[model samples]
Target: MKSAHSSWETPDPGYWTKQGYIIVRTDERGSGQSPGLLDTMSRGTSEAFFDVVEWCSEQPWSTGKVGLLGISYFAGTQWRVAARKPKGLAAIIPWEGMSDYYRDRVRHGGILSDRFIDFWWKNGVQPNQYGMPGRAARKWGRDTIEGDLDKATLEQNRRNQTLDTVTHKFRDEDYYKTRDYSPEDITTPLLSVANWGGILLHLRGNVLGWMRASSEHKFLHFIVGRHDLPFYYAHCARLQRSFFDCFLKGNDEDGWKSGKQPRVKLCLREGDAGVDDPERELLFPHREEIDWPIPDTTYTKYYLTAEQQLSTTSQSNVTSFAYDAMEGKPLCFTHKTSARLEITGHIVAHLTVSASRSKADASPPSDIDLFVTLRKLDQSGNEVYFTGTMGDPVPITKGWLRMSLRKTNATNPGHHKYLPYRDYFSTDVEKIAENEHYEVDVEIWPTNVVLESGQSLVFEVAGHDTQGVGKFSHEHPEDRKPEDFAGINSIHIGGNHSFITLPVIARG
Candidate 1:
């Protein structure tokens, strides 16, 4: 199989060699070893993977069938290539990689990703194209360098700005076209593996790909802990090897020999404070349930009361939180569990919001952020947090819609109602307006949880960061404390329209 490292590490040949699998690790186009313009978002990269597969099949040492493997960008390319239905491509194991560039990796809850492509390209993508800088040069750099630095060294970096100029063209047609994977075309068998903490990366896109693809033999596995750390474990590695062995080596029944349904494993760690959890902790594999928005769910609405409370009872003319950039966080609502219950499915948010800035001042329309968080409170009143596919601890179950991008799709049923899929949205160029109120829906990614009696299922609606609370939270020097955390958010509510929607779970 063909695998290449992101600007970081290349595939470790020693590991693949021991398994008797021939590994082809090359840099993506415009990256190391390869020559061409760098398409950071996997356009040319997908074609490269397809080319490698065909090459491998034709080689003397090759089997007719080829399987692709890798994590993050590598994992993502699997879907992009599979969508192309490359000849000789057999199956794919996209570990912790997002399927949709628009939904999972680049944007979250309609907010521009905090991890900007420009920043990543400048800091991560370019350096890998060149050899690692010497120790002296490393001191001035800002990325994951291991050494110390001085002021003069930092000054030198300001002049080396190739990445800065390239990534600013994010919305260019060339960039978007390079990353598109229109699912209707993908027919290959797929096994998507991800870390629960890798939530923002692979979690939703994995589920979306598994459910929507043209392929019938698709599966998903989510083993919790952190991103990329699972690959080092014995059990995890065995699972991956078995997957490739069955698909690539034509060992058809091998993966199912033990009578286990294809599973989604979630690592369960102790929720105690001050206890450091090991990476790739444990695996809890679940049998496939019905497709998401689980046919079994009741599309229930929890009214956002004028009093700022979430209750099952319906109310009208609610008081909304104005879209104040400086507003405090939204309040949370919890329900005491009367029985043991497990909620496994997608959650939706529907609210009416208005912007404080004028159309001239706003970035075109407005990109408003609504934060949706799901938490489980123990009987002792302690809160438990889960890690997202990004390998960060996020109480955030899912995030959606920056308001202005809330376009309705007349074709897709998933996009028709209060449940809005996080598909990409473009600007409505001619109709832009300022300080207008609009109703929109946000779909939080799917999650699986078991709540016991006396414990409550809690949902917090706020505009703030959920990262700093846990080890798995995505962080950087830029994120602020309380002002950005869940405690305060500014929202405006005045019309009879403001409210939040929930997929009410009911026992059969």
Candidate 2:
């Protein structure tokens, strides 16, 4: 839905129209034929979306009820718009879309996710600008109905997301605050679908959105596969139609009619289902839960041993592991188990960490970038990868944090031991000093995987991204300058700073 390119067909008209639905897609302001300022995720864009939904609900051909559904950009906007609670808005199906713009898209752990922003701007936004010429020739969309704007006017009207993201580092800044809204305000009937492999982006936001929304009729469902394919799958389509049919059309072929359906439905990932294998996906096991976090989920801590091993025993001893900030290698600790352990729900890592000067360094770094990865290995010891966004192989999950941005908002209602919440405000920047140990918690993205006997789990911490980052990378030269982030990083393993909390589900 980037710029609503107009030719993108993930909506599948044949599928919706045949179900007696009128499919209406818009080229939102400054996208395609619409002429105005081109601000992708600002409050202005959300207001426009809110207005358009109300407009659709008022049309003479309308049934006075409207349900919102879309993937990626289209889906991400739904949370903000639905929070406004416009007239006749009935339900929303935000499949694989992020709800939090700051946490999910622009910044990862307070670090600028500049690569994806630049890539999206050039390929997704620039070509489809309101006044761009030759759009029809390029097959992007029809050109501006009003004569194209001059280069100066065009440049002045749009916000460069990459530039704005780089310029603003904290949530309190007007740049991000203008885009922020409370998900708790969204009371629309909702069915939010998350992807296990959306490690670098929407995974965390989707899960949080479902939890924070005020909708009594909300449900959280999960799926696996490439980004665009799963949304159009027959089974997923049936699920969507059933949800909207019940809420918008006053008919429920499924249990949604009486709201007796489980609030959480999950795809159980036990082994390597392989990437984008649609046939095998249908056979994956599933579980239905009346509440998330499973109620019986025991938050167990895994400690780091002197030998860099992860264990359940309380091995109390001072141990240190160091990695070169610029060396591009990570310190890994693996845990192997013989019992079936279903690790689901929220995950967090507690570590006593510090930065120091390496021999190759001219000066010590002022902060550390902790890139954490949780991985699964088969019985024979080969690493197992799951289907991530765009069908790439990713680890079980990933988390990130900057030592300077390690301050936690413990007073906030959303903060919990299972998930360390941070406002990422300008005031939360606690700069690191050399040789001083500071305790920090990193919020890993939510995941679901059943560990079979002899399978292993590995947790990694590094000064840079390890793997499965794809285009959503934080490699902007300004944000991660060598002088500020390149030196030596250390993890103090013992007591409160050396363990990861996993949501261990009791096997039946």
Candidate 3:
């Protein structure tokens, strides 16, 4: 059900047992001790998980009230299973898990995130696959209870995530469509923990789940620190225990039954803090709000000027900046902060752009891949970085878009200010005619940063990955052909054609 060898960073059984609660650890189908066709994240696997949760409700010694809790893959499964509305499922805490497979994991803004898919398949998923040879000797997990399958059988037993990811380009594909679910169907009482540092994969899903799930008791808590460590933090554990105790045991000691608790709790990244430093990360502040993106957020726009600058007023003249579609430094614009302020929520960039042939004889590129980065700079013009998933000092946030999939779903209810929802389906694809300027809105992942009076922001536009992508890159050759995506990309910052909409919290 999950990719982490079914170890899942599950907490000690003895601790919960001592609290008069029984904890059951499961090696889901085709993982750990369980044996079956290995199809991680497949619909069939999720159905099996649904059966298990229902069975737990029928157990004689069980309270008939089940609470699901885990990290990453384990957490991600909670969302899918809960969507089934399994009987006796009381509550869930999906810590740092991705909800949308296509948008969050396989593809980013429509580009195939093949690098992370390859890395995760080898390191996190395949090695722990049931009956994988040498799992016992190499300490991946216990040897299979049954005799291990042979080489050919092993290869045939599992779904190849890498191959499938390459094959499935859009959400409408059978491979991806079958995995999709409505977040509103997840009606379980939920505590969805999102990590701001998990910008690459887990961050967006967690936020979206919190925003879209129909659970009235659902709460969104944004934490800071390593994904591995934050979930087990003493404060986080206390939060989990209180939530579970209220729902599972009928003990509402924390007033979770009523509206006493804050629906949204956010970890404030105000000043400079080192990546992966838990002590310093916890040193940051915490704020309570009623909703995600804050209801009163002032979505301010920073205009991309013809002078190749980020300004408040648009220049009268038209202008454009160019960069090699498959190479070269990103074009950047800076805006110095005049007052101390905090920007904490979703971010979106509006751009007018086109692709073309590099030379007279070269062929035109029919597609363009746009990579945008929002970086923080100190008063002295030095760059500031936040903690990335791998401890890499990354920008405040990043966004991407494949030019052909630039059509926005404005009619959808989810589409709103500060965020543009795009259906990355085959039918949603727009023809990217060469040299035709198209206006598109790029959805940036949620982020948080408090800037001092002199601190500034750098808005970077590029044709390829900038800082903070880490191992999750999109460089698949067939998917990004040179003739279709490796030419010249130009950003037309004329009038209102190009600008970035930043989420600003208005201090009342």
Candidate 4:
């Protein structure tokens, strides 16, 4: 079921309606005007969506063919329903959708995104619930029938969803797996649109969905803008029309049928504010390739050295930095390149760390919570942040991990080199013994950037996000603002354990 408000309207329905195609938007069960418990992303919701699709195919005005297209919640539902492979479903465009509920939304890097979820529930879901009194209800009118459900039932549904997220701290739990759909189950001809700045919700799914989906006719496109802006943009809309026309209308003349569409179209940011242009035109330079994780990518390793420097050569000397887990600054390492470098694809950092009880503290910390950020710096050493999907400047990419959940899943294969999948299921939690060291691999979200000559790559290893400033501060309540962490954390560097692996693309 769609969780967002205004599910009835498509971004630009005229593009489809003008082509003589019927567009249907239904309020999902328990949402909008639909009568049912508002259990978000439940198996029941998926089955209900399937029933709607199949029913639509049998309608009098129907051609017995159906397709799905939408952004965010709409896009997310498409992934879940398509996995069921509903009969009469022809194609789907999951534009900027989050595939995995745990990885993409709730628990990022095993940390609860309490702020985002709380913001969503209060500002997004509650106000738009069937009979809620707010702007959405004033404009769209209340779903009086569904509103008939006792207020207690409505409050319980909201509470259940939030409680489920907080209680199930690990990903391997049944709560998360039941809501997660396998990309292998999605066989429909699919066009997945991803946004580069959608680190918080959209990017991971778009990229991972394309990689895992068993569909033979799948295509991926990357756009740079606010999460919802691309859906209505003429450039993206044209692409969507061509894809639907080729699959649904059997239009052989459509560019997609002629093999003119690139398997991956990545947009590169050109200026400070990539989303500044009001029209949101595709103005940046881009690359077209047959697939993602570009074939000729050179995985480069930049080691964290004793002198707080990032270098290509591994050093034998071990380095350590201790910080108050709650208020200490991050351990940063900067490296300046001699020549221009273009980096694309997934990035992973191999770190060896140990935690201990601080002399000034009363009790020992059971686990170490680490937050890693990859950033760019100008020649003058100023931090470079890019405009994100929300119109705010954000660092290159960020990753987090509770050291206790750092065990890697050797059985689950990685999608790319240096990108090993970690298992949050196995609970092998242990406190650090004196002089004990643990090897942890942190997966920094995938990024595409062109580092000009003399530009420096800066890596920050901290207990919390350094960019949590002003309007952009969306932090995990516990991880970001811990009441008190009575321990000093250290990052060990030397030998083979401390290096950041970058997916460096070779230039001609």
For candidate 1, write residues 50-135 as lDDT tens digits: 78778887888877777787777777777888888877887788877778775676556444454445455566665644223442
Instruction: Report the Cα lDDT for candidate 3.
Output: 0.85
Best by lDDT: 2
TM-score, one value per model: 0.77, 0.97, 0.96, 0.92
Q: What is the lDDT of candidate 2?
A: 0.86
lDDT of 3 at 63: 87
Residue-level lDDT tens digits of model 2 in 194-306 = 99889887888889999899997999998888887778777788888889999999987677847678899989998778877867766779989978867889999998777
Give me the overall lDDT of model 1: 0.57
Model 2, C-alpha of 57: deviation from truth (Å)? 1.0
Superposed on all Cα atoms, the candidates' RMSDs to the truth, in angstroms, are 6.8, 2.2, 2.4, 3.3
Q: Which regions of candidate 4 fall more than 4 Å away from where they truly are?
A: 1-9, 131-140, 143-148, 156-159, 255-258, 270-281, 414-416, 426-431, 468-485
Predicted candidate 4 versus true structure: per-residue lDDT over 323-412, tens digit per residue? 767668899998897887777889888888876666745566667777888888877777767657667767777777767667667777
TM-score of 1: 0.77
Q: Each prediction's Cα lDDT score?
A: 0.57, 0.86, 0.85, 0.74
Query: Which regions of candidate 2 are displaced past 4 Å?
Result: 1-10
What RMSD value applies to candidate 3? 2.4
What is residue 64's positional error in candidate 4, in angstroms?
Answer: 2.1
Clashing pairs in 4: none
Query: What does the lDDT read for residue 423 in candidate 2?
Result: 92
- The model with the greater lDDT, 1 or 2, is 2
